[model samples]
Target: MRSIAIRLQELDDDELEDFVDIWLHNRSALYYRTERLGKTSDKGRDVVGFVTDQLHEGDWDLYQCKRKTRGSKLGVGEALKELGKVFYHHLKGEYATLPRKYVFVSPRGITGPLQTLLLNKEKLRTALVDQWDETCRTGITRNEEVPLSNVIRTVIDAYDFTRITYLTGTLLAKETDAGPALSKVLNLVPDEAPEAEAPETVCEVEMVYLDQLREIYGETSGLAFTTINDVLAHPVHAGHLQLQRTRFFEAAAFDRFHRDNTAPGAMETFKKDIFHTVIEVYRESHPSRLDRVNAVMKHIGMTQVSLLGRMSRPPVRQGMCHHLATDGRLRWTR
Candidate 1:
């Protein structure tokens, strides 16, 4: 799966909220009895869900879900303010039954300062303890007397913000937490190194090839050709020749010879003798007249014009052979 950071960046505001709703739904049983009640009187409350238990007659819990990027921390002030809105809704007869519990959910988790605030705030503290107690009785153990901040941290520690959000939604609908299951499926080790970085720009590979080409041939010679094949075939001014380049030249020569000649059964004989010689020279240079042989063969169309019966050739035939040798350009070589 792609990183949470990457996925979060792709989602818009509404998508993010929907994502949070889904994540909370999947990861926590607390969301099982809750139904998303839509927008609250407070803008801070992105989602309002009513929680009911068998023991309680009506709404037992109220949840305020907040979604943010990983590494971000939500403060106590935000938690308190959200709680106050829930309380306000209760007082105004909006939820006449009045929720017995209040909960805050954040993707990034809550800040340390917020945790302290929750601990100190009498009403908020009671609501959290009560919620924790009820959840514990139902075999859903609260890992700790965690504040809203700690809850956020736990989610972040176990899964990335995006995955946590995704899990929440899955849990809500299925009554199952997908995070732990996903962790097992992924089989990720905590200490493993992250994946290798992707190349930042498109031109990087091309630039590297150009640099290597220039190092083998002179910089001036490297820039003289437009096609990659031309650059590959050019002799390396450097002492050592690349094995890769040598193989390329032989392959290119073999293809060119067959392509230029229209004569039937020409390639069969040519491949046996001339092609064999070309391949040998391409591997290791022979000292005497070997360079001259290569130059001459390249000067004429190596495979195109064989030492055939005729001493005289037509103008167009001569031009075509010459063009094949010089890569379709008039040769200046003496």
Candidate 2:
């Protein structure tokens, strides 16, 4: 069996064309294999393959694969270039006896602009859908008829969205059930009360703390008054010390104090000690430190027990440390 990672990596242009061909031919025997018919003699054709029991008579389809990558497109220019080859082969009576069809397989798909360009062209649009339908049916599933609607539905079903909202309406929609539940669990619901009048611009100590919090975490970390208050009240959090001090202190003084009091490796040692202590305390203390933190967080209006549990987990040597470093909760450069 192919690994998922390998399968994901294998889903490039050629594989996609093969996939489409397999789907179209519906060859249950699975003897289908794609071939490159020589760069020089093949002309425009990139892949040539036969599906068993496609037709009572000798019936086959030829496809020109234009596997576009990022920022690459299959425009009218390229389509016309391939079409010219088809015209050349037709004029030479190469496919006079056999039923022949021309196809352009692009994984990224032909853009709307290019589709319009093809539609506007009299010759290209004339039998495009019929030819494509015939090709797909004969190539992937011998006699089965697969509608365009089915194909569209397949593509639409592949996507998963977290949020859905109307641009023009007051109402909002959520695409996933888990999203709303998780949001509610995290206390992220928007207030339904009447919009308060905009406050006059004024400097405040709370605003300064909010800015500091934003700098420490990030703007979207949702550092509200309740979250900050909870963080300060938590005895385990080192930030609690700074919360007690005034916000107007100089950066130099703060840095000097931090450097002088905390030894070079002391912070890491302290962090480890605190982590172990939390785990030991939880294992030994009555009601447990984990229960205490959860209770405290809940008292401060957080309903997410899962988040608290996650926060209370003992730090392992691997993933969590890396995560902490990546998220700027732990320093690595020092």
Candidate 3:
């Protein structure tokens, strides 16, 4: 497995631009609607991300992508030229207002001189003003001297130059959220199960034992127990009622087991295996025909007690015993 950064570094210019678009979408979809601009008509922006408040009406951010080869860095002149486009467009009323942020996206990354300028807002502004004549002046205007107003200058001075930031290929490649985009770009199979937080709640089935007990008590006593308290108070059904109560607390542990085991139908298979294990325990007890139902119940409870050997959940054993007595093939008394 090649590292994501190393793989990203290998992408050509066109692919890198597309990958950055996807990366931004994955990374900031909650806060921004990412838009990719065409190469020639883009007017400088390779991608523009509008804040989620209301399309272009809200604040916006800009991205300029460069796919430079290894050892090549973004020059100061090139950086200045890109910055000029934002100021130039705002002056011409091409934008409603200047972007809240202006980011440079590149695989090769910015040169040392540009990186130093980016460290301090005042220094970066000074560098931009100094280089305006050579790099930005012509790019901002083709025909005549573009009048830069004092108001625009005040806005520029107040503008957060710190908003000018860089996104390196290494950072993009290492982002966990950007995995799908990177995999798409590299033409690799995506991970089937990326790590995610466990859900706060797990779905549950209605109490299986409670339903069975109601059926059993009705058959034995000519009336079904209408409430849980009635079932617990009934002398014949009291033990099984206690077992079902214990299972409610044990639900969280069972849910974790179900989630940890990834096999399909694993929960059903686990229940089936538990039933078989209980049956084996019952058969080994070998209660005699002379044994009454009460004696049989006691024999199973005592002799078959170890059926739950080393099990994490003790309440599960009680539920299994209830199942065996009521519904399982194992007869309480022959």
Candidate 4:
């Protein structure tokens, strides 16, 4: 398979713009709305991120996308021209205020020299001012030259050049949160299942399943089981209770994780599959409630859950029983 950066470099200009819009929505929590300005006369903004309810009047960020061939990097001239457009247009009052950030989005990334200039905010500002007469001044408009006038220079001086940044396809691929968006746009597989180790401390959300287990233990062991400590004191039931809790929490984590990563209702539908698969076994008679629980677990091991693909591990499915039990859907003792 082609690497993510290589694949990104292959997308047409419109595709790249649309993807940056989607990717920004997924990756950033700051924006209330995002738009891809695809028209040629978009006044220098390719993608706009509206940060506040005031929309253009309040605060926004500008994303300028450049789709280069696989090996080529964005150079100082083009970078300065893009920066110039925003500043020149802002001077003409194209929008209410300058953007909170001006980002250069490219698949091939900026050249090493440009990267060094960006790292030093003062140097980048100097480069922008020095290069404006040739690159930005002419390129910002066909009709006239946008000189680096005193007014423009004052705005640039007060403005934080440090807000300028770059995002490459390589940096984007490293974001685990972007996995779903990448899969949707790039047709890549979703990232691998995240680790779901059960926490050592029991959480309040486990109360429902723990209650069921405690009551079931009382039925088999002939004890009152009023408190958790009482149950823990029992040599036999204590270990069993711990294992059940572990399974329940692990399954809970797995369900929460896949729900966020997979398609809508996927995890819910998978849980439903487990319930139907085990409802018959759960209805059968057993010597004790614990025996019934164990039987249902064994049944799920042999059965198949095709909904989640490789994500449906044995422990994850087994934990679904407690998922059902917590919602009053399945009860081992009842």
Q: Candidate 1 versus the native: TM-score?
A: 0.31
How do the candidates rank by TM-score, highest first? 4, 3, 1, 2
* Tens-digit lDDT track of model 3 for 128-198: 77677787767665666644456556666777898898877777766666654664577543332222222
Native-structure RMSD, model 4: 4.2
- Expressed as tens digits, the lDDT of each residue in 1-334 for candidate 1 is 7654344434444654554454445434554443444453342345444454442246455445655555565655545445434433343455555444555545455677665555555544444334432332222212434233444323223321111111222232232233322222232112111122212232332333334444434444434554444555666532222332332234334434332321234334433434343434334443433243334345333334332221212222222322232341222121
Q: Each prediction's TM-score against the native?
A: 0.31, 0.28, 0.57, 0.74
Instruction: Extract clashing residue pairs from model 3.
Output: none
Identify the candidate with maximal TM-score: 4
Q: CA shift at 93, candidate 2, in angstroms?
A: 5.1
Q: After superposition on all CA atoms, what RMSD does each candidate show versus the true structure?
A: 23.7, 20.9, 12.2, 4.2
Strongest candidate by lDDT: 4
Whole-model lDDT per candidate: 0.38, 0.36, 0.61, 0.80
Displacement of the residue 53 alpha carbon in candidate 4, Å:
4.1
Residue-wise C-alpha lDDT for candidate 4, range 188-254, written one tens digit per residue: 6555555465566667887787788888889888888997667877999988777777677668777
**lDDT: worst 10-residue window of model 3:** 194-203
